[model samples]
Target chain A: MRKLFSSRTVVTIIIAFIVIVGLITGSNWLSKRTNTPPFVQRFSNDLAGGVSRLISVPTTAIGRTANSIGNLLDTFEENQILKAKIDQFAQDKVRLQTVEEENRSLKKQLGLQATLTDFKTVSAVTISRSPTTWQSQLVINQGIKAGLKKGMPVLSGAGIIGRISEVNTTNSKVALISDTSEDANRFAITIKGNSGEINGIITGFNREKNQLIMGQVTSDNTIKAGDLVETSGLGGVIPSGLFVGKVARVTKDDYGLSKRIYIEPAADLGNITTVVVAVSEIGAK
Target chain B: MAFWQLTRIRVVYPVILFFLLFVDGAVMSGMGAFFTAFPWHVLPLATLIWLFYGVQFDVDKDMPFWIYVTATGILFDAYYTGIFGTYTVAFLIATMVMKQAKNILDERLLSGLTMFLFGILTFLVITYFAGYIIGIANVSIVTFLLFEVLPTVALNAFFAVIGYFPVWSFFNFLR
Candidate 1:
């Protein structure tokens, strides 16, 4: 038998180690210089994502069915609640229609053309969530073939969910705002106040509390609880005026130099399956 | 070369590795949605099963086992999107260590379990340190161990216990 400490085996091990370390550092450098991953890496991701989608469909369906069956147990209570809210919904619908018509007329008089916020959206089903806990990301069944590109905003039924991070030919990954990973998921958000707009950046997510922490608000801003927060469009890729969430509370930042706003995300990010990728106007960024 | 040898070692082995990669990338993650309410996360490294098989059955001390480990690690890094070469290096080191230890380690249930646990622990520690050094992992070491490391180890250990015999039999059958 060949000796365990043979020169050939030792040299192979050392060379392998050096090569892997080189690859690790080299790939990181390449990825940083180019915003997109290399094509080979992307192709591997696509292959895995495609196979995963096939396996996950039945699992997702089973989960949904189980949830539906559980919900059936509370159907009567839900029906009663819906019955009580129907009249209130009717009144709000009429009021909203009137306000929308007036707003459209005002916009016509102002002669303002449709803005970047006016986007064409394509729907995609989420194939998987990232298995790692450190990052909050979703793999969706849409990609460059579907006109998806990096930085395009994604939304669920309630509000904006995240932005597309990497796009392959047939699949894309979205980095959720809740992810604490460096600058990738940061959002420039505007909190609309009766007097003026309060601007802040969503810095991190308080996962324990299930709220978004928006910081860097100037102390002079007249921000308050229950104000609506939306994308400010300052970041360029994300469109202006996509609803993010409502401000749950206002607090002082760690340094007390500025205000921190806690936002309750409008979308039930925990239970999202279908999402819309908002394809914004070209050259808007 | 015999047809059965070519098919088993070249075709079936790589196919099994690819399937495991798919399960790790897609199926485990799809299942993660159901565990959103849980505080701790459980990431199952299905590839570890194959790695263990490589260590146990690689009687010739050939290059195929190492090649499979490297390819599996590369595919994992591609799908995971955390750090590019973390798994590649970790898997290589783990395989090397396990290969050296195989001389002393017996091929039995308890020994198999111990081997798997040792492999997984080394993989996790190495990957975690590499990720932290590269700025991919930002959590404190304590928090990482509590939330990610401990749970992952436990889950993968359970997989090792239950999956060991079946995987062993399959590799034997292939031989």
Candidate 2:
């Protein structure tokens, strides 16, 4: 027994026991205690991001080259298909001009203020993607320098894109409205001829499918297929009357009072490159 | 063969651990350049330190063991941690406890695994806690376990097979 009482043996035993106990009970406490300093955390994050950018540049360039080569290998009819799309754009532009002129003439007749000038649009490009899929977030090139703030709305050319989640000095993480965990309420949405409200929560289901599901809507809203949904301006963070999506399928719950409408959001979220950040009109309550 | 003299062999393992951590950082970063998604997870280094001493029952040489333990903590802190130096304190506490476990388990594979597993687990918990303390990680509990723990365990196991022998050999030379 005396021989077993060696100083080294005793110390090792004491240390090991404490560590096991600490790990079982004090893991959270230890984690909270050892956070990196703020400045260091920010600097390291930027450095890591910058390094990743430098590393990815060559890879992206190669991918683009491959894609262009693949496109050239296709037959001539593919080119005709593209040409038709271009012609459609030309006709759409002419029609838009005619509508604008007609709208102005009608506004004069009704003496109403023009609404198109109300929105201030600033375009931005995505810089980084979150490593994990649990958080579907993107860091855009614009930041405080571009007049971006927390909760500012980001939009795809089609409809409501997301809201600014975190703003750094030169970049900001946009929490896409499609992100499932988000509890965003008060979406400024308008349905077809009703011109009233279609309210619910926005979330993303499958990244591969690139769809946004707006659920928990009221069964009384009279939502139907192909109805255009737009932002209602109730959140005050986003402007009123911005197109959000179209009602795809509407189903009632067990209670039959609340409806779960699966919205096919207007934005093709997967392919979005350039997005507009609503820098102005933040907090315009 | 003297009990007290066994300290010479014991000191070698800790020194090897300290040096490996430095190389681990540079190597992992360098590997990341090539693979882009190379499983480069930094599990707690102290586990191996604990297991090393835990297996080597003659590690009762207090002075040498503590020094090696402290060195392990410092190396881990310096290499992978965001704020730096915090891992050193956590590691020392972990190693000290491992020294006790060494008394019961003779230097063997099973004992080593036990210590290593504990070290790795502690690292995950501590680093995440550190993240919250510093505001680097604000993820929910479920996300943390999914993103941090599961991936780390897989990476650690992969590295363990490839890394263990070389590390053991280097430490054996010192012993």
Candidate 3:
């Protein structure tokens, strides 16, 4: 058994250790990068992405069907609630159409080709979510081949959930807002304050509290609870006017020097099946 | 004349592992309602099960096996975790430690179960710790142990126990 620790084996162990270190450092490097990952990895990810899609699509469908059937008991109550909202929804639909027409005509008169809110969307299915707890992520089937680019905002039916962090040839990785990693990018956002628009970055996630903390608020605007928060589109990547969530609470940071606004995400981070990748014209040449 | 025997072990084993990995993702995809409180459910370790299943078979932890582990680590990084080196290092160390433990313990059904469970612990610890160090993972040690480790172990152990005999017999047949 001493031969297990022989010179050759020791050398092999050392080499293995070096490889591990290299891999870890490489991963950290990739995390900080906003650019597309390596070509070979892209190609490999494409192939695996295809296989995973094949497996997850059917499996997820089957599971959802089972889960929905189990929820049949609640549907009656839910149906009553929906039925109550149908008349209100029809009125809102007409109002929205009128506003849309007015806005278009105004933009045409102004000769504006595009605005911060103008965007095209490519819909994709959530192929998978990472099983590990630390990093909250989703693998969507849409990738670079589908005109998806890095930093594109991924929205669920409710609101923006995450942004495309890594885009491969045929698949991409969406880093969810729930991630608390230092390396993850913060979403540039604005809160609709009573005084004016209060701007900040969605800087941190408190998983235990189930709230997203918005920080870097220099403005002492009178922000209150239940205020609307949405994308400011300060950064060119995400489109403007995407609904983020309602302000859950507002508090001072640990130092008590600045305000931190906590938002309850509108996107059902857990139940996202299909997502829309919003491609804004701001940075696209 | 034939250098290759146990064709099923060599070829079919990986195929099954692949599906297991996919199923792992599928389980998480559907468990969205419970995502806020507990994001992951039943993190199916195909490699760990592969190890458990092959305990009775003459499965060598050789160069090819190590390469497969390394490859799996890379794929895991790119496809799932998106953090490149975490699994490569974690899986390599865990597999090596698991093999060492196997040598020390007698090959009984209970022992095999113990080793399998222990293997899961080692893998989870190494992975969680590695991710923590890299500043990518955000779960506190206490939280990691309570939420991630507890559920994962319970479910994965149940899976191992349920599949142990059938998998062993299947491998036995392959031989």
Candidate 4:
């Protein structure tokens, strides 16, 4: 028994324990207290991103081929869908033209300037997604060197995907809207009713249904299914008017005092390859 | 002279382990992108594999092997973002358990396979629990076990099997 508790093993174990404790505390402090990622962390991520880009070429090719085959299989159905979309798009184009003219006239009459959402956009390609299951973060190739900043809104072709979580010199990480972590609850958004006055907060993501759960909605608000939801710009970082999603359904909360609206996200969060970072102008509110 | 030779031979392990870490972070992640449809989360558990290999081959239970395990764990934690020290502590505990159990377990292919499976399961459970305690993991136990744990175990086990022979041959060649 005495031999089992040898001084060497005891010392090693103690040292290991101290090291473990130090690491946990240090990392937590770094993540929470620091505004920017440490230089070592950024360098490592950039190096890994570069290597991942090189390794992704073959896999990207395979993915492209698989997508091509799937597209080919669905060509006839897609063609029909496209035909229907074309007619709808033609009508939308006319409506959009009239709205644009009215918007221009209103801006001229009011002498209003461009809003925060009218920032410059820089394109970026996803280098890798974090392997950890808890967080759904994507590392994009462009970073602070390209004028990307933390809290800047990221948009896909469809609509808003997420916001920049961390920015390094050459790459950045985007924390997806599906991330249900407590730190990820900064998105202040609103549901656009016919009256345009319904406001709610995106509380969490329903993974089973693949929907965003928006809660804190007043029972008095006449929100219904199919209402357009968007960022309220209430959170100073994210600009207003960025499309979030359509309300799939509305239900009473457990307390039955407020409503919880399930949103079908506009951007496909699961399968993103490229994104645009909306770089807000300096000092833009 | 004999001690010097042994130290020189053991140097290769750390080199190989570092290389594996790089490949796991860079290459394996990109490969995971291809399997978007399936719930296939392919993370390379090279450190776990190294622990298994150490359990199987290091009959003498050398100090260098333990150091390798510790260093690999620390490096993995440094590279991966999340609750730091989770992997390091998990790997250390796993190594200690394996070292204690090595006497009863025979040095054979079946034992190696069993150890590999058990090691991976233990490592993942520890990681999950540690992350949960640190407030990083928001996943429920059932969801984590089903979607993340099961797929990660299966994929990592496949990597361990494919990696076994080459690693075995390399260690032997180093000797």
- Pick by DockQ: which candidate is best? 3
Worst 10 residues of 3 chain A by lDDT: A179-188
lDDT of 2 by residue, A1-285 (tens): 459588998998899756644543353334234322245444544544454345444534544455467557885879888887998899999998999799778878998753422457778765444322223355566765677776777887787778776555565666666454332222545565354555544534433234455656663656678888776665556776677778787777568767666667787554344589764443533
Model 4, B6-47: lDDT tens per residue? 544466566666656555544433444443333434455665
- DockQ-derived CAPRI band for the predicted complex in model 1: acceptable
Residues A175-203, model 1: lDDT tens digits:
77766655345878888987898776888
Point out where model 2 deviates above 4 Å.
A1-53, A62-88, A101-117, A156-159, A183-186, A193-211, A219-222, A240-243, A268-274, A280-285, B1-175
True contacts kept of each: 0.35, 0.00, 0.57, 0.24
Superposed by TM-score, candidate 2 places the C-alpha of residue B63 at a distance from the truth, in angstroms, of 19
lDDT of candidates 1 onward, in order: 0.74, 0.54, 0.76, 0.70
Least well predicted 10-residue stretch by lDDT in candidate 3 chain B? B54-63
Stronger candidate by lDDT (3 vs 4): 3
lDDT rank order:
3, 1, 4, 2
- Residue B102's C-alpha lDDT in candidate 2? 59
lDDT of 3 by residue, B98-142 (tens): 677788888887877777777788889888777666665665778
RMSD of model 3 against the true structure: 3.2
Scoring each candidate complex against the real one, what DockQ results? 0.39, 0.06, 0.55, 0.31
Residue A239, model 1: Cα distance from true site in angstroms = 2.0
Q: Residues B65-99, candidate 2: write the lDDT tens digits.
A: 66665655543432233223446656665554555
Worst 10 residues of 4 chain B by lDDT: B32-41
Interface RMSD for every prediction, one decimal? 3.1, 10.4, 2.4, 3.5
lDDT tens digits, residues A34-98, model 4? 54677877787677667667755664556556667766999999899899889889999999899
lDDT for A251 in candidate 4 is: 92
lDDT of 1 by residue, B30-130 (tens): 45544554345567677776777767767235346667787877776777663477777788777777777777789777876777777877887887677
